[model samples]
Target chain A: MTNETASAYPGVSALVHKHLPKVPFTADKTLTDANITVEPAHFLELMQGLKERRELAFDYLRNVVGIDMQDEGLVCKYQLHSMKHRHSIQVTVHTPPGNPHIPSLTGLYAAADWHEREAAEMLGLVFDGHPNLKNLLLDEDVRIHPLLKAHPLQKMEIAQGIEDRDPGFKF
Target chain B: MTVWPEERLVTADAFNTVDMTINVGPQHPATHGVFRMVLTVDGEMVVDCEPYIGYLHRGLEKLTENHDYRQSMGWWDRTDYLAGMACEMAYCMAVEKLGQFEVPERAEYIRVMMVELSRILSHLMFFGAFGADVGSFGTSFIYAWRERERIYDFFEEVSGDRMFPTYFRPGGVQMDLPENYEDRVRWLLGSIRQGLEDFDGLLTGNEIFVERCRGLSPVSQEQAVDWGLGGACLRSTGLAYDIRKVEPYSVYDRLKFDIPVGKTGDVFDRFIVRMAEAWQSTKIIEQCLDQMPKGLVLNPDLPKTLRIDSGECYIRTEGTKGEYGVYAMAKGGNKPYRMKLRSPSFCNLSALKQMVVGHYVADAIIILGSLDIVLGEVDK
Candidate 1:
C-alpha cells in the first residue's frame, strides 16, 4: 500500500481505478464496496496484474461464486482480499447464454480448484482450463445443474426415482 | 574377506516393497465425520492421497434460494454444526447488510458474546479430537466434553437448543439474554480457563505428543495463502489477518484482543495457535459482558415479513473453522435471489492432497485432524 492509499484506507475502488486505466469496469460507491466487471478475453491478464502489482496485490482469493443471469448470461464472481493492505473487492466476469466458458483461475489460485468445480457442477458454467472440474457436492455421474433459475427446486432430476426428461414445475 | 564374481551381484536377494492402497473411511472414527480418503503407501510412507467428500451434502445453497429470508436461518446453522451460532451470525449479518437493517447496540454485544462462546466451543473440540488423533486416547476428549456440556447448557438456556441454536435474526437476535446471563457466563469462563489448563498439561505439554506433531507437514505463509486455508491454519503461518481484527464486523472492532500467530506454521503451531485463540475468545466474551448495554435484543421496527428491493454484499466472519462467508444477492423479493456460502472447510480440505502426500500414513490422519474440518460445512 502506498502512503496515499494507506492514509485513505477504504478508497480501494479508487486505487483499482488508478491501477487498471485501460480496462473498462465500473465501481459501486453506495457501500463504498465496488463490483468491477472483466471481459472474458482480458480476465486472466487483469487478474495476473492484480496479484503481482504491489499497490493492488489481491493475493488471497477468498471465494468464487457462479450465478445464472437468465437472458444476460452466467456470471462468475471472484472475491479477492489483500492481507497486506487489508482491503477487498469483488470481480465479476460474464459469459453469454450457451457460451458459458470462462478462463479458470486454478493456476493463479489453488483455492479456485474446488470452488470452480462446485460452480461448474451447480450452474453449468464451463471453466476453460480447470484441470479436474468434476462434480463436487453433487453425485459424480448425475448430469444436473441444480442452481439455474429454470431448474425446478421441488422436482429435481435426482429427487424422484422416475427419470423424466422434463417435469412440471411452476414458481 | 570372501570375494564373489561380478555376476553374483546381479543374482543377490534384495528386500522388496509394493505400493498398497488403503481406504480410510467415509465412516471411520478418525475421519471426524463422513469423509473418505484413499492413501497409496510405499512401505508406511504415503506416496499419494485422494480425499472424497460430499457424503453429507444437503444442497444448502439451493435450499437457501427456495426459502423465505427469515426461514432460511435454520439451514445455515447446520453448515458448521460445531459452531452453529457463529454461522447464524454470519448469515444474519449478510441479510442485515442487504436490507440495510439496524441492529441494536445491546444485541451486537450479545451476539459477539455468543459467537465468541461458540468459537471456544469449537476450539475445545479440536483440542480433544486432535489429541486423540496424535494418540492420547479418551482422556482429553472427556476433559473437553466436561466444559462443552456446561457451555451447551448455557446455550440451551438462551436458545432452547444445545447444538443448532437458531437464536440469531437478520436485524439482531431472537430474544434477550437471561437476567443472570453475565453472572453465569462469568462462572462458565472460570471453568473454561481451568479446562484450558488441563488441555495444556495433557496435550501441549506432553513430550510425546509434541514430538509427534512439531515439524509434521509444515506449510509456508505463501503456500497457505495460495491454498486458501483460514482460522488457525492461516494464523499458524504467522499472518495476523483475522476478519475480526482486519475487517471488523459486529462489535469486534470496539473490543480489543490480540490475534495469536505461530512462527513455523507446523502442526504443533496450529495446535498451539487454537489453544491461544481459545484464551483470547474468553477475553472477548468477558469484555462483551462488561460493556454490554441493556435494550431490545430483536429489532422492534422490522415488518411482519422482510422484502429486499435490490442489494448485493459478501459478509465475512471469523468463524470457528475460518472465514465463514456468505455472498448474498437480493434481486427484489422477500427471499434472496442467490446466497452462496464460501465455507472454509471446503477450501482447506481441497489442499489435503498436497499436505498429506509425502508423510507417513499415520501422520496423515494427524494432519487431517489438525485441519479440524466439520464435514457438514465442507460437503454443503
Candidate 2:
C-alpha cells in the first residue's frame, strides 16, 4: 500500500486510522478517495465500523463493482460516501479463487439490494445474506457471468449455445 | 324493489377478494421504456410491486471492458440517451482523470454549457412525460417538444448528430462552438424561459395536478440517502446534495448556482424541484457563455491512441437524472481494465418497490414517473 496519494478529505483517513488501527488503508493515487482492502472474513466487521462509527458515518453506498482478477480471484469493490461528512471511501474485498462468498451489505445499507444482485450476476460472487440473489441486468435463467475476463465478447452466442458454428477469433 | 333470498344477499365481509396481479409494460407506453413491473393489488391499493428491468440491457460494462478508451464514448452517451452530452461529459472526465489529461479553459466552459443544455433537455422531457402521466396527455408533451426541437437544432449545429453527439473527447471537446452559437443559445435561452413559464402555468398552477401529486409518496432525507436516490429525487427529499455544488467538478466551482430542495419530498416536491432545476440550468448556461475563453477546444498534447500506464479513478458528475458516476481502472493497457457506471437512474429505480407499496395503483404509476428514470440508463 502506497501512502503517496493525497486524500481529498484528510480527516476521513485520520479518523479511520484512529478508530480502526488494525484495518490497513491506502490512499488511491488516481482518485482523491481513500481505498481499503479487506479480506472476506473481516469485511462485514470493517463495513459496520465504517457506518456505525459517527465520525466515519458512511451512510450512502454509492456503487458496487465486481472484477474478475484472473488468477488472483474475484474482487468486489464498493464505493461508500458519508453524507454527513461529505467524504467517500472505496473498499475492496477479495474472495478465494474457487470460493467467491462475501457477506451481504443489504442488511446494513438498503441500497445494497440491487447492487449486490448486479455484482452477483455479473461476476458470480455470492453474497451470503442477500435476500434475493438473482440476475439483475441479465436474464433470470441465464447462468453465465458475462463480465469475467475468460468470457469472450464476440463468442457470446456460441458460448450461450445459441449458434452451433464457431466464431474464429478469441480475446 | 323485490327482496332477495337471505342466503343470496351479499355482505361486504362475505366477498372474497384475491389479490390480482397487474403486469404493466415491457411494452406499454406509460413505463417510459422497456421496463415492466408486476403489481400485486388488493383492490385499488398495491400490496407489492416487483419491478423487472434488463429488457434494454446491452451489456454496457462488458462492452466497455473489451473496447479501447476512445471506442467506449459512444456507448456511454447511449446509456443516458436523453442527455447524451451529460453522459459524455462524465465518461470523458473519467477517461481524462485516468490519463491525468488537462482540458483547455475554453473547452471546459463549452463542456459545461452543453451539459447544462442537456440537463434542460432531459428535465423538459421529464416535464412532458410526468404531465402525461398526470393525465394532461399530449398538451404537455407538445409543449416540451417545442423547446426540445429548438435545443436539438442547436445541438445539431454544434455537433453532427442531434441525440448522441459524441462531441466530447477524453481531454476536451471534439471541436469549438460554432461562430453564431452564442447569439443562437441566447435566443434559445429566452425561448426556454418562456417554455418554462408555459409549463409552470400549465402544470404547476393546475389544481388537479397539484392535488394528484401533493403528499403522495413522501420520502425523507434518510430514505433518500439510504435508498441511494440522487439528482431531483434526492434533492426533493431536501438534502441539497448536488454533486455539481458539493464536489464541484470541471468548471462548476467557478460558476454560481443554487441547489433547489423540497420541503416534504413528496411527488409534487419532486416535480417542482425539477422545474426549478431546469430554470437553474438556464442560469448556468448563461454564465458559461459569459465566462468562456477564446482558445483551442481539444488539448493538442493528447495522444492519437490514448493509453494509460496504471491508474484508477471514480469520476462523479451531476447527471440530469442524478449522480452519474463512472468508476474507471486501467492497468497498462489501451482499454480500461474495468469501467463501471454508477448510474443514478438504476439506483433511483431500485427503491421503486419500497415507494410503490401501499399507494393506489394509479398513484404507483405517478410515483414511478416521479423518479424520472430513463430505461436506457437504468438497464445499462
Write down the C-alpha DockQ for each prediction: 0.43, 0.49
Residue range A1-171, candidate 1, lDDT tens digits: 000112333377678778877766765532324567878988888888788889999999999999998999899988888888777888889898899999999889998999999999999999999999888887788777889988877644434446755465422
Listed per candidate, the RMSD to the true structure in angstroms reads 3.2, 2.7
Best by TM-score, which number? 2
Error at A118, model 2, angstroms: 0.6
Report the lDDT of model 2 for residue A114: 96
Each candidate's TM vs. the true structure? 0.95, 0.96
Worst 10 residues of 1 chain A by lDDT: A1-10
lDDT (tens digit, per residue) of candidate 1 on B1-380 = 98898665654255467799999999999999999999999988999998888899888998898889999999999999999999999899888888889999999999899999999999999999999999997998999999999999999999999999999998889999888879989999999999999999999889999999999999999999999999899999999878888777887878989999998888999999999999999999999999999888888999979999987777888999899989889988888888999999988899999999999999999999999999999988
Cα miss at A112, model 2 (Å)?
Answer: 0.4
**lDDT for B201 (candidate 2):** 98
